[model samples]
Target: MAEVLVLYYSRHGGTRKMARLIARGIESTGAVATLRTVPELVVAGETATPQQADDPFVTLDDLKNCDGLAFGSPVRFGNMAAPLKHFIDSTSKEWLAGTLIGKPALVFTSGSMLHGGQETTLQSMMLPLLHHGMVIVGLPHSEPALHSTQGGGSPYGPSHITSESRRQPDNDEKDLAIAGGKRLAMIAAKLQER
Candidate 1:
């Protein structure tokens, strides 16, 4: 099966939940999805050693081996969170080797408010992957949820708006995520066929 790496850094579990649902969508398309997370990065306190969370920490090898990628993060001032950024910055060797070139990619994010920079966070994640020469994947208007989602679904990628009163994504958001994952997996599988 084609393997797609699903990587993310989530603080309040919103991004993590979206990642899981996306992975499910990938699997539904007969592709394998490897879920991975980054370590917490803090500047002031005792710097904690890197450790695995519920999902194992991603390695350069994951990038080299995966047929596709799904990168997600929480919004930090309309950008990707620092922990995820740190990990991406460390992939210089991989980038130099063109490890991810021609691979398919998807990006996702979660925001605390309805208007909270989710698209920008997704774009921030896409920038590095674009430099790595990955073909970015996106949701299409054909997806019914995209036309009507009020929580968080975008043509750029799947997103969740965890507003002040909400944590879990609504049905529309979840469906979009799954559709995006499925679309990514299908594209990856098609590419592998060549």
Candidate 2:
């Protein structure tokens, strides 16, 4: 089966949760979604710590081989988390090869406050993928939740803004994430079949 890579970096688990929901949506389209997380970067001579057992690190080959992509991260001051940035920075080889060219892609993010830069973070994540010549797929206004939700859905992409003190994805946000994933997968599948 074709696989869509659901790649993310989540420090407090909120972004991870979003990744899972997107993966579910991808699978619902009958395309496989491979969940991969980046390991925390430890500087040389700094203490190396293990990431959570379940959140295994992503390798560059995973990025190169996936049929499509769904990237998620926690908002870090109006941007994606540093760890995810670091991972993307290491993908120059793929960029040079144009390995991701024409692939379908989607972005998702989790933020602490309703205005905590969710849209900006989603846009920020798109920059690198755009540079790779990947085609971006975002939430369309056709999704009723995008119009009705008071929080966290954007035409740029799906997003989650945490209202509670603890950052977590709400139901509407998850629905948007999944919807975005499904949209991406459907586009990719059609392109592949063509």
Candidate 3:
């Protein structure tokens, strides 16, 4: 079956909630949404070991195999979280292989404050995908949530403002995320026809 990989890293679970909403949107379009996340960073002098988390950690093979991607992260000083960036940096092999070329991709983020770099974080995630030659997708104004969301929906992608580690998505944020996912899946399905 065709699959759209919904991959992200969440420190406080806020981004994870958004990931789920996006996955719902993807599946609503009859495309598989494969939700995955990156492993946590090893602390200073800590031996690196495997983790058994709620969602399986992402592998390069998953990227190579996915038809589309919804990449996300929690904002960290106006950038994507370190774990997600670390994984993206490791995808050099996939980039060299052109594994992600032409895949439809989107980005998302969650942050503490209204202007805590959510949009920039989303854009930051897009740079790597663009380098890999993936087609970038984003939330459109046509999504009514974009117009109404006072918290964190952007034309760059869907986002949520935690205000202080709140993990739940408000109505407009949920609507925008789902809309973004549906749009990405629909685009992926169209690309598959070509």
Best model per TM-score? 1
Question: Candidate 1, residues 1-194: lDDT per residue as tens digits?
Answer: 78999999988899999999999999999999999999998778677676548899898888889999999999999999999999999999999999999999999999888788988888999999999999999998999999899889899999999956798889999999999999999999999999
lDDT of 2 by residue, 1-194 (tens): 56899999887777888898899899999999999998887878999876664656788889877989999988999998888999999999999999999999999988778888988999999999999999999888889888777778899888877745646666778789889989988988987886
Candidate 3: the clashing residue pairs are: none
Give the candidate order by descending lDDT.
Answer: 1, 3, 2
Off by over 4 Å in 2: 43-47, 163-168
Give all candidates' CA lDDT scores. Answer: 0.93, 0.87, 0.91
Better candidate number, 2 or 3, judged by TM-score:
3
What digit string (tens of lDDT, one per residue) describes model 3 on residues 147-183? 8888999899999999654558899999999999999
Candidate 1 clashes between residue pairs 3 or more apart in a chain or in different chains:
none
Going through the candidates in order, what is the number of backbone clashes in each?
0, 0, 0
Stretches of candidate 1 off by over 4 Å are 45-52
Q: Please say which candidate is ahead in lDDT: 2 or 3.
A: 3
Measured by lDDT, the strongest candidate is: 1
